[model samples]
Target: MAVPQFQHLAGRVWVCPGDPDPEAVQAGVAVVADERGSVLIDAGQSPTHAREIQAALTAAGLPQPRWLVYTHHHWDHVWGACAWPGVEIVGHETAVPLLRTEAARPWSHHYLDEQVRANPRLGPSFRARARAMDSWADFAVLPPTRTFADVDELPVGVGLRHVGGGHAPDSTIVLVPDSGVMLLGDCYYPPPAHLRRPDDGLDLVLVRRLLQDDYLWYVSSHAEPMTAEQARSAVETT
Candidate 1:
């Protein structure tokens, strides 16, 4: 499949579509540009993916991001951060320790293959997704430089809120008031299959809370943007 290009969402927001292909998974990356500069929603899966996003932005004549925000500490959302050298990274307070833990992991190809050999249920899926990139030699997980508790408001009218959910305890949601859009970073998805645990109603609760907002569009990391009603229906049915 051809690499997806960043599509304009609304206002200053643009998104590069994510792929769910089992052989290689990728989370969508987005950017919100303002007079000050631009704030990137997620860094993507690898240096290659990050560069794809950069090329798309350059093709569209958009400015390089001034800040990079991780919606969570998930590998898919953060591994590409190293590509954006000087950009200040931000995440939820709970994500700090999680990222530190990730930074300590061995991301080499051999280590990943070993993990698959040790753990069957989860390892194969993980290894398959990691295959998205040709090399893991340059892979590094960079922790966020700035952390926030509940909400952090940026000068560009972008808001970051730490709303933990079933998918990840450090999950966060980004609100772009300028575009009336909310970026949902795998926050409503149920826990991984290996966890063997239910959301325990967290999905509905979070969806209800989110619907109270004035967002016109909700974009999940792995799926296309949705309407407020569509989000509500998705959560209720799931």
Candidate 2:
């Protein structure tokens, strides 16, 4: 398989490509930096993906993240956070309790078994990576050191808004006002009528409101960054 490449969105924002496994549900990691420090929008799917993200940051001459902001409590987005020690992890308040759930258990062989069964072709690789991730003591739930009730501001000039929908309950949207870039973790996805849940209608409305602000670039977890206009249309229509 070809090596994944990190794409630069704009001013101090770069995205590390995610897993290419057809059965994998990983999200790309977004690295943002400023004079204050750096922040990661989300850690990738596994320990391997996290290592790749770290390498990419070093290659890009960016500092280690002082903060890891989770978009939500999904395994694909927050599992790799254990790789970054001493970094203050941040997320919405709802995510705190969710992180402590049995589902977040790193060493749970049952979870790995289920994944392997779900993707038989990639089962061996998935099991191998799971074993590696489980080996880390810190691999267990690395709950957010800092939690926000609604909206919060980071020193890097990015705003974390609790959009509250999509794939998870604690869904968040990251807005970098200075860079005019918005990182919409898994909050937004392309067409597939079934993917559009009725419960997320309000969330879509909230996303539309944020997109009304001055933004040039819109980055989603699973797809290439799109222009502000394209993003707005996607949010409004889908």
TM-score of each: 0.92, 0.81
Model 1 has an lDDT value of 0.83
Error of 2 at 4 (Å): 4.0
User: What is the C-alpha RMSD, rounded to one decimal, of candidate 1?
Assistant: 2.1
- Among residues 3 or more apart in sequence or in different chains, the pairs in candidate 2 whose N, CA or C atoms overlap within 3 Å are none
Among the numbered candidates, top lDDT falls to 1
Model 1 Cα lDDT, one tens digit per residue, 156-207: 8889998898788889899998788999888977776567465344466777
* Candidate 2 TM-score over all chains jointly: 0.81
For each candidate in the order shown, give its overall lDDT on alpha carbons.
0.83, 0.75
Error of 2 at 220 (Å): 1.1
The digit string of per-residue lDDT tens for model 2 on 1-238 reads: 3355667888888877665553456577888876577888997776667887888787777788888999988777877887887789999999988888834454556766886687675465456456446455546666688999989998778789987654677889888877888888876433223344554443566567667557898887877788988877877787
